[model samples]
Target: MNSLAALLDWYATLTPASLDRIAQFYAADAHFRDPFNDVHGVPAIATVFRHMFAHTEAPRFEIAERIEQGEQAFVTWTFHFGLRGRAYAVAGGSHLRFGADGRVIMHRDYWDAAEELWQQLPVLGPPVRWLRKRFRAA
Candidate 1:
């Protein structure tokens, strides 16, 4: 299968036990950045996944859309998990640049932490919603 196909499959089926296989999709010096993390290298990337598993319960990703052109691909996905005894689903997308060997060299995730994450919290949700309304264009 093609690298993008394989990557989508990997993410869809990702589990804490399978994190060890992250190296297969990322180059040794890969750079990965997301709303909450900016890290380089495969080991550091693994740490991010590890932290995810440590913090959330049954965190999994479902790929919603994919667009590929040459060595670059963009994917939209939904991340589902439980935190603080509550279930949450965060919608996000990622831009991936592949190396000559088909390993990901750069992976940047796009997500709004304020709207997608903090807004899900009980105390912060009200303030965030109020602020969004206050700043919204007329």
Candidate 2:
């Protein structure tokens, strides 16, 4: 398989134990960003994954689609996990730019934080939903 395909497959199957292999897919100076994090370098990336594992149970990814062109690729995915003993899923996508060596240099994830996360929380869910409805366009 090609490098991009391999990388996507690896990510879809990533686990806390496989985090040590992060360096193989991301460059030393890679940059990663999502709804809540903006970090650089492989070790920092690993730390993000570690934090995910620590806070959630059985976190896993399912890649729904991938589009690649030259050194850039976009992957749509769904993340599944258990938070506070309750299962939750968030649908998102990643925009990745690879270096000449095929290691990811920039990775940015796109997702709706309010709908996917904040609106699912026990204390914040109601208020967030109400606020959304109050200001939503008709």
lDDT of 2 by residue, 1-138 (tens): 228888987888898788889999999999999999999999999999999999999999999998988899999999999998989899999999999898999999999999998899899999999999999998
- All candidates: TM-score: 0.96, 0.96
Candidate with top lDDT is 1
Model 1: how far residue 52 lies from native, Å: 0.4
lDDT of 1 at 133: 87
Q: Which ten residues in a row have the lowest lDDT in candidate 2?
A: 1-10
How many residue pairs clash in all the candidates, one count each? 0, 0
Q: Least accurate stretch of 10 residues (summed lDDT) in model 1?
A: 1-10
